[model samples]
Target: MKVALIDYGSGNLRSAAKAIQRAADENALTLDLKVTARVEDVVAADAIVLPGVGAFADCYRGLSSLDGMIAALNDQVITKAKPFLGICVGMQLMASVGREHGEHPGLGWIDGAVELLTPSDPALKIPHMGWNQLNLLQPQHPVLAGIAPGAHAYFVHSYHMVPRDRAVVLAEADYGGPVLAAIGRDNMVGTQFHPEKSQATGLRLLANFLRWRP
Candidate 1:
């Protein structure tokens, strides 16, 4: 199976690639995982993973600058129904708009807005860095298979996707309140945290993602 780990001039591509490789090896599944910026590569991929770091507007611009990328993604993921995963700022891009560094348009795949985290307690912090436990909302979801409730995942972001529909939230984490840790619907799935950097929990999620049918 071919999995396209999209390189849109951002994200820690090497780490994600390595984690995917490790997951494939552990699962004994032979996968053609290619990290590419080429639109053609994404068009032919069985699954697509979009990982991003930095501001939402910048990442969106980086993706939009790539000729035919947005169109290819729409065709392959929205129309063709190939599985899609977005990580961190990548996940934020699925929202209708991101309110970071001025208002920025997003892919609008999910009905939500990316807003800055406003933890109730002032001492909770902004970025919400380090490991946090996932409060599983959709325990039966395929992308979350083998990932038990309360699994700690590494997170490094200030903005979070405030999904319009609560059902879309696959898991949540509490800082000062419930933070959207993951969301999924149909063939699309996303995580606010870096599953690649979450150690065993991350590895399990990656493995599940590879084996996921939808």
Candidate 2:
């Protein structure tokens, strides 16, 4: 199978590429993975991975900057019904809109908004960095097959997605309160944390993503 790891000048693509490659190797699957920005490449891929870093508006602009990229993504992912995984800001971009940088539009694949993570506790950090435990809300999700509850994942963001439909939330983590960790519906799945940096837990999720049919 072919997987397109989108490169929109958002952040480092090496770690995500290496992790997914490792997952494919461990699974003994002959996978062709590429870090690409081309719409044609995205259209031809079996699975699509949209990885992002930095601000939501910036990432959205970068992804949409390429002519026909967003439309192609919609055609391939939404129309074709291909499996898709969005990481971090990429996941945030799936929301209908984002509050970061003065309310920017998003892919709207998922019915939600990306808003700043507001920890009720006065002492909690803004970025919500470091390791945090995941509480699985959708245990039967294919992308979360081997992932266990309370699994620690690396997170480094100040904003989190708040989906309009609660059923789309796959998992959540506690910051000052419940924070979104993962969301999914049909063939679409997203993670607020970086699976590439989460070591064992991350790798397990990556492996599951590689093997996931939907």
Candidate 3:
């Protein structure tokens, strides 16, 4: 499968692609990878991957500069059930609004909001870095196959997405509390953490994503 990694100045495409390549190798699957900043890549890709880091406002501005990415994705890929995945701030960009820019609008593909990760726990630390266990809410889906309820993965972010619909949240993790860590709605998949940086567990996660067919 040809996996188009959207490289539009907001994400770590090299690291993400490296991890995905490892996952493909592990699963004996061949993934033709491309870091694309072009319009045709989104349309011709077998699946789309949106990976990002940094502020929501900056990311949004960078993405908007691409022209018609949001529209093509929302109107064609997502609405038409084409496979798509998002990582870290990439997931946040899919939300309707983010507080990063003091009410910055997002891609509005998913009904959700992104807010700074405030420490409800006095001792827990911000950013939520390092390895943490994922609390799987529903493991029945193929996208989560072989992934246990308490699988560990690396996380490095200070913001989390609060999906407006409970049905869209596939998994969560205990940070300040139980924050949304993963979301999936039909063909659209999102992760608030960097699966690419999570090592073996991360590889498995990406492999599962590659194997997902719904």
Candidate 4:
């Protein structure tokens, strides 16, 4: 299968690439994959991965500047229902608006908003990093299947997702609160955690997504 990792000049590109390679190797399957900023690659790709690591507003601005990138992405992902994956800031961009930048509009592909996870408990650290357990809300999804409930995944962001549709959440993790850890809407799926950094569990999730026929 061919997969395209979006290179929006976003951070974590190489790590995401290595992770995909690792996942494929673990499954003994070869994936035709490359990192390109080209819109045609995204349009023609069997699966599109939007790997991001940066501020939501800045990422949005950069992507918007790229000629026809957002339009092509919308055509392939939002309209055509091609399998799509977003990581970290990429996931944040899928929200309707993000408070991080004074209420900037997102792709609005999913009904949600991005906000800081405020904790009633004191001493709750922002950017909940390291390995944390995820409660798989939608276990039947190919992207989440075989991954046992309460598996640990890597995360490093101050903001958390609040999807308008609870059904869109595939998994949730506790950092200081129960935040939407992952989302799957129609042919689109996104992860706040770095599957690349989560080791075996993360690889399983990525591989499961790749093998998914729908």
Q: Pick the candidate with the highest lDDT.
A: 1
The lDDT ranking, best first, is 1, 2, 4, 3
- How do the residues 1-214 of candidate 1 rate in per-residue lDDT, one tens digit apiece? 8999999987889999999999999989889999999998998899999999999999999999999999999899899999999999988898999999899999989998999999999999888999999999999999898888899999999999998999899999999999999999899999999989999998998888888887
Q: How close is candidate 3 to the true structure, as a TM-score?
A: 0.95
Compute the lDDT for candidate 2. 0.92
Cα lDDT tens digits, model 3, 1-214, are 8888998899998899999888999899978888998778877878888999999899888888888877777765666777888999998888999997599998888898998887778898887888888998878866778887888888988889988889998888888788888898888889887899877767887998887777
Ranking by TM-score: 1, 2, 4, 3
**Pairs of residues at least 3 apart in sequence or in different chains that clash in candidate 1:** none
Q: Give TM-scores for every candidate, taking all chains together and pairing residue i with residue i.
A: 0.99, 0.98, 0.95, 0.97
Q: Candidates 2 and 3: which is better by lDDT? A: 2
lDDT of 2 by residue, 1-214 (tens): 9999999999569999999999888889889998998988998899999999999999999998888999998998899989999999999999999999799999999988999989999899898999999999998888888888898999999999999999999999999999999999888999999999999888888888888886
User: lDDT score, residue 189, model 2?
Assistant: 92
Consecutive 10-residue window with the lowest summed lDDT within model 4:
119-128
lDDT of each: 0.93, 0.92, 0.85, 0.87
lDDT accuracy of residue 188 in candidate 1: 95
Question: Model 3 segments beyond 4 Å from truth?
Answer: none
Candidate 4 local lDDT, residue 62? 81
How much is the lDDT of residue 197 in candidate 1? 97
Candidate 4's TM-score: 0.97
Clashes of each: 0, 0, 0, 0
For candidate 3, give the lDDT.
0.85
